[model samples]
Target: MNSLTAFARPVLRWGGDPSGGAPYVFADPSDPQTYTGFDYEFAEALADKMGMQAQFVPTDWESIVSSLKRKEFNVIINGFEPTGDRAREMLFSKPYYLFRLQLTVRKSDGTITSLEDCKKYGKSVGTLVNCAASRLLEEGKYRVKGYQDPVGAYEDLELGRVDAVLMDVAGEMFYARSNPKLKPAGKPFQTGAYVVGIRKADASLKADIDKAIDELINDGTIEKIFRKWNLWDDEQVKLRTATPPAIEITTTKLNWSEGLIKLFKAAMITVLLAFGAMFIAVILGIPLAVGQSNGGPLIRALCTTYIEFFRGTPVLVQLLFLYFGLPVIGITLPGWLTAIVGLGLNYAAYESQIYRTAFQAIPERQWQVAYSLGMRPILAFRRIIFPQAFRIALPPMTNDFVALFKDTSTAFAIAVWELATAYRELANATQSYLGIGIVVCCYYLAMSLPLAHYAHRLERKLQRKSTGILSSGAEK
Candidate 1:
């Protein structure tokens, strides 16, 4: 405990709050990164004053509060907006920055004129789970769904899955500016204040953080930090502007199962896609491999070129090229089709290589001997080459199949339903471990058990055949 306290890691949950005021805290949609915003700069300045190296670690926004409450960190230094109710759960530093909470609907969505307008349309309200807008809507009559991050909410909104995304004024602006593909709703709802949250019991740490805020405010450091991320605009310093629910809502029990089902569905899709693609790849691969190795120089060059192209690029790029770019050039495909085709083609290229190595091991003399014995080329291969190659290829092919199954989950980007997507939906919605556990078990059983059984059977069959010859022909 002493050693741990002396070098305790101060972790802050980024992307936790919905305002997205700190551009640093907003998660990058294209990457696995979460950042700390300009407000986080002030937090770092405090660590410097205390002579402590504060290493910033990003965690799930939804679960961060519980982690902070449990003392996962010495402090929750990410910019946190504390409601009076939330204040009961955690201590608050002085309000470092005031942000305007806004209601953002697609500019094309025409119906949502105000925050209250969402109630009339029966359009689901989108917000970060546990975000301020979510809490406000929880007590109101609007159908609200809390998502894992701003991107999720924006995605749901853009897809028309939700009528509007509730965020602070600056956030809606940032998102709108960055993604010209999306249109923000007509106007924004204004809110009162946002602050940095800390464990309530840490009155000492609270004082330290609160004191830091005071210094920043007095020295203009707060102003500089917000300016850097473009949060210092009217939205950052001002607390109110346009809309908020007239009355607070009391949240109801979420169905939670709907979220679970969505998760399971996603995982199943991924498993099937990967499993399906690998099966096709393995089947198709054998022919290409055989052709490349034995089909003169021209066919070998063609096969080599195909393998290099697919293996050289990232799987995601391949998927996108097939789904998005191909349509531009006149080849239109369905989402599932794109996933299956892309995955199959890519793995086939790799599988061809794997199979080639084993197929080439058959002695060139064997083919000549078979021909000398008057066996046709096809008969020679069927009766001699393939059976031996199969035994040799078994282990490596098994290993490849195992990896391909996991790779199937990446089809989520193409909107292909799979295990990984399902778990992501579940993890975001239920915000629990249930879906994750189920997915882990499902994939493990799906990939490992069948491969294990097949390997065992193949090994046994190899022993019995001992190269598929009826007799060695040398009398024992």
Candidate 2:
């Protein structure tokens, strides 16, 4: 049985902190229930018409592309554009909506008029990352400050971080209606039509979804949702009246040697980055952990704060900040360096905690014996405390390898040709998991599953060695 799902964040989300003001975007507080909007209504009707169980995939908006390509959702039934380049990647259903993108700016600053006119606004134009408007910003020579979500872009505009924000016509109006500071800076620019996306390889599913859209429109369900939202404009009505065309696709064969070679290449890149980062992490983490565990007040405090800060915040942010963020401070690391440095720092912070715990778990008598045997505190810790701590942390330290392996995927954001990037590119291009992605996942499992199995083996072996009766040579 086949199922279809709609992908969307809440239509109504908030922006900006109310008190101190640092931009926030959240699902509509007024309407707390899920699937309350016109999008949900359309999804329900489409499912009924197609006779497939309708599923709603609540996403962070960031995951839309990744989730769709991962086959986590079969159909992306939100405001997605059918662009020339994207058409090469994923199949699009007949547009259910014709959206005009609007440039949003502070009502006080009134200079912009059209998409082309946005050039006068200077570099700090803001838009959602991977959005249609982002392309416009680039083509129009506007430097975009890409935000994670729509509200974040608007918040940037409001806070003066950016001169303007660009979004779909509905989002512009919807956000503008609620927030008085923001207003359309120009004429509503027609960007193009928006359609639900289906992975191109899923031809049958794509056909069924297109058929369902026609069915729902014929039965008046689509119009019902549009009218309910006050969005049933006459222009959109005319567009929908036309017959939805079946999308045609052309397929190409894989370059057997070239692809396999690239696969090996990417795998090597991923492995090297993961292992190198983990190696740096272990080297840096141990000393920091020890210093924090036994150092003077200021040094201990610094180490504790470092551990807490890195552990509390997300590693992805740190990576993005390093890759994209550090340039603001006149320090630049090439993307490759950023990947290794960020991954190393994140795991180092985590590894420090692990070592700290291992040290604390050791018996005080072990330290005393070394000290009583004419060893200095430093020598006692080096000869006695460190070895036991290493033995104690051996299992958890090995478990860290799995996470370190997964962290390599984050390099994709910076355009590093790691396995995940290849998987995404191939999945988008072929629209089939059996193509490049199946091979890539095999690579992931090839790399990770063994390390995981080894970590498990190491853990068990260490457990056995620890529990074994102390022999004359056991002290080593």
Candidate 3:
């Protein structure tokens, strides 16, 4: 006890989505700076039991599993379920809490009640992506629409965009409770337990966590934590008493051919998304840049505002707003269209600055020479100014194109599967993060390397031409 008290706090980091709504892991409504949830308290308690201090690591829920595989955190305990696919990748502690799926729908909608009914009628059901509920819906052959957050899913149900939302009982209870419009449609289905996902290679860590979980349950600490969050249930109480079997460790063969085929197919989508977005950005950015540079005060202000607004915000937020948020006001865009437009508009702001800078870099004497030659403003720009600016901008433009190639992965926010998403799914299933990560990185490099090489050659060619022009003038 003296040795333990003498030591400093040892931090145990666990990742979760604080914006993922209440009773799980979210910011305190009363004090946004502080986080309070069942998972939050449970993590703290579990960490204390292990002679450590719990530190909540906020992560994007969509890629949370991959984040774990990357060792961003010691464990994933944000109501994570132990699935066969996940088990192959990570070790899990005994069940800490049990939950079941709840179908949330509009109170007015009395026709739909169960997953089977929704599937038979082809109703668009909403759920969080890559979760047990979503997998259940997909495996049942139901038309499932995935959201980044359960709040968004419930919002869709409220706005009549989706017929129903399939989420965990706790999420539905916390998020949909006291809502006049939405209600839980039927009894919970597919009962499951929440387990702590640990690194499979770290068997010692897994054993430590399992021991801590047993101690928490034996001492009634886990139950008290659940009661504090008003999440105590009979199944969870039963889970505390029940003995859990040891986690089975398994290895999967690296099927490079099949993985490569899947990667190439998804990479095609990445290429299309990048090309389509880059086309719009370049086309719009040139004009916007010109306007920002030469236009009157009002036009400049408008152009500046457009550029800052898109550049200031995140691309993912814009994609989600366009694809899901707009439907609330009756504007529903297709996924591909939303991905391209959102990416294009956001990047246009950045590209405009590049264009403007390149335009300014060219000598003012060039424009004067064009005017002196009796050339009109439009002709001066087309014949002389644009060519030089294009040369200056080409390098940056190539860099931006390469950047946008990787950025296309953000399209996954709007449910467009690209290379990154492809590898995440493949890596999770095959438990081959290192191998798959290398391959995916190679795929990106394969696309960008040629563009970079060409850019390098173009720059050198232009440099030689400029030197020759200077030498000719000096000789004359």
Candidate 4:
């Protein structure tokens, strides 16, 4: 049976982050469990035109494009702009809504109003990372903070973390429109258009969507949806009246030649992130283990609190907290350093527990023997108990290294493009998520498997030595 015809109700999954709250996508205030937004309605209309039921998939905007390419959804209608870089990776539908960057600020604070005023006052602005707002900030040499989403930037403005928020006019309408505390500072700048993102390889799908969007425009269906959200504007009307060119899907053969070099470089970065994080883990984890095991009551309590705090919370949250949260306290850290510290601190908690268990498992008789030999307490621990504890910890330590290596992929949350991030980019660029996924898996395995094997071998060797046996399986 044909897959399309087999389903009772064919589902077209649309990816978006509803937490963005407002005209774009957010939980329906009337019904908390249900979603409602302009984009949500637009997706449903598109799915209806295609004779499919729209399935809303909640996704983070930072990785929304990546998620679309990963086949997590069939389309992304989350106000994705048709930028040059993204155009090359994915097919974009006709512009459904026109947007411009609206500078928003607290109404009570009138010292800064325009971009020039912002520059003069040395005011820092916040914008969504990798967006046109960010690009504008970069080109203008403005001190800008990049956020994973527009909501976060606006929230920071509310909290005085940033002086202003440079975001889409549509976003401003939803987020800052009715607020008595905030107001638009000046005229919107940097005009752009919002479009639906479709997978490049699925040219037919793109063509169908473009046709449906054009139809929606002609029949005034989209205008009704826009009006429902109170987003109808002159630019939208102009877009509707203008003729749209037919979509031309140029099917390009998947090429890995250039991607291989990029993937290798990214893999190297992953290695750096992983090993760097692990180095921090081990160097700090050992001392933490010692403190918890051998230190006085206060020291032990402090060590326990530290271990439980990190281990209790998620690594991603820790990373984001370090990167974004610290800037609030005037302690901004670079992305690479944030990745290292976040991963290291998180893993140290786990590694400390492993070391503690190993240390405790060692018999006190060994310490007694060292004392009888006239060795000092610290010396006895260093020379006798420590070696055995390290040996006992090696197996779990090896496992942790492997796990930590994989965990480094999360650094992409803070814009650190490691192996997984590289693969997502390559997959989108080449339109080969399946192929790149395999390559990335192999890359991780190549990095992790050998270490695990070696650690196992060393563990076996230690076991044999402890039993007084030779390699030939005979007694020494």
- Model 2 CA deviation exceeding 4 Å by range: 1-33, 59-70, 201-208, 243-476
For each candidate, what TM-score against the reference?
0.62, 0.52, 0.73, 0.68
Candidate 2 accuracy as lDDT: 0.68
* Candidate of highest lDDT: 3
lDDT of 4 by residue, 1-476 (tens): 36666366688899988876467888988998999888999998888887878899998776678888889999998887776557777898888777778999988777987877888989988777656666567557687666666666666677666788888888888878777878899898666877899998989988888888888888888899988878787767667555652222222234577567767887898899889899999989988988998899999999999999999898999998997888778876666778988999999989999998987777767787799999999999899888788788888999999999999889877756588877754565445679888988999999999988999899998887573211333233
| lDDT, residue 210, candidate 2 | 78
Q: Which candidate, 2 or 3, would have the higher lDDT against the true structure?
A: 3
Compared with the true structure, the alpha-carbon lDDT of candidate 3 equals 0.81
Candidate 4 TM-score, true structure as reference = 0.68
lDDT of each: 0.65, 0.68, 0.81, 0.80
Top-TM-score structure, candidate number:
3
TM-score of 2: 0.52
Candidate 2 per-residue lDDT over residues 10-71, each given as its tens digit: 22111111111111112344764533455666666677676544666665453465577677
- Per-model C-alpha RMSD: 7.8, 10.1, 5.4, 7.3
Clashes of 2: 2
* Model 1: per-residue Cα lDDT at residue 13: 33
List the candidate numbers ranked by lDDT, top first. 3, 4, 2, 1
